[model samples]
Target: MGNSKKVILLGNFGVGKTSLVRQYVFRKFSDDYMTTIGVRIDKKMVAVNGQEVSMIIWDVAGESTHQKIPNSYKLGAHGIIYVIDVLRPSTYLSIEKEISSLEDLLPNVPIVKVANKIDLLTEKERIEIVNNLPLNDYVLCSAKNGSNVEDAFNKLAESLI
Candidate 1:
């Protein structure tokens, strides 16, 4: 394994990508809607499966028109956490398109499908969405409550390592 792993947080605007990162790393939450102007970087040392791992988490800007993330960002990423809002069906629908684009840019890199805001969905609705996906790798998470957030990161780390 590399000395450090690069992971990118990807999703559409207003889908809680930043909120998920903030909650995971800082354990805080807010209801504000601020567009991420550029890539925000955070680092943490994690112990995954008994080995120490350093994570260089790139919280990529959500704005589609913002060109802050250069093409090079996709080159070195070991894994990607593709987040989609469970409360917003359109965001869920767009996951495939986003994944396609990512694969085109970085084929063969592992991707962890994250259904964020799971706390807002009922069991039936959650099941419906899960049943319809490609089902390679996925996690149901709630950044607001810290549910399954660590598991999502751990799963990605496990794959990368």
Candidate 2:
């Protein structure tokens, strides 16, 4: 239960990376938007298969491209949660490229591809967007509404074990 794993949150700016972290760790959401300059770290213990796993979540500052992120922020990562705002096409248009870069940087590290802000989309909109994105597998989450936030993190935690 004392096992700790490093997890990184990678995505473009304003894709709700911090919001997802806050929602998962603190169960709180704020309306104000603040840019993460470098990186923010938060710790949450998740019960993965009845065992507590300490997730050291690194909310790195969002960059337009994965190549722009500092290597220091990505090293030693056990997993990554790549989040995308469902309402913002720009956030996910280059997902295929970004994910490929991520794989090259951290080979064998599991990434939980997430589509955040699903609460803002209707069922039809969700289906349409999912069909349009270049994604193999992804989880729909809404940080503002606390929907599937835990599941996304837990899935990553389980993979770490």
Candidate 3:
């Protein structure tokens, strides 16, 4: 065991924040859409630079605007996993605004932008979506099929160290 870091998942409703946390921490995914009322916490150990780092994940309930999230939930976070659904442009249309709000709350916190539910899209579609997204760097993941899920968390863990 090694030092632990606090990480948070933030995004709009139904963008798969809970699903990503479930997959990363438990290696399981479900189609059921259980709305998170407040926040769900989970822990996972990841090896980064040959050192074990415990990742404390706070899966906060999604809000239309990041500003609406409870300030208490945003504090003490070492990293942020900002997720969006590839099928919903509306979810990410205000990406700059959302990210800006996060930055305001947690300045200098490392953020891993993620596009979840990639399993629902074709390979070409995935590439196109990534290209069109405003983010220069992000992970394309599928909680349902377990693609790039580990890599995403590993990247965040690495940054924490």
Please report the candidate that would top lDDT against the real structure: 2
lDDT of model 1, residue 54: 89
Taken over the whole model, the C-alpha lDDT of each candidate is: 0.79, 0.91, 0.89
Candidate 3, residue 1: Cα displacement in angstroms equals: 11
Whole-model lDDT, candidate 1?
0.79
Each prediction's number of clashing residue pairs: 0, 0, 0
- TM-scores of the models, in the given order? 0.85, 0.95, 0.94
lDDT by residue (60-156, candidate 2, tens digit) is 9998887899898899999999999888889998998888888998999999999999898889988998888777788999999999999899888
Per-residue lDDT of candidate 3, residues 75-135 (tens digit): 9889999999998998889988888878887899999999889999888987898789877
Model 2, runs deviating above 4 Å = none
Candidate 2 collision pairs:
none
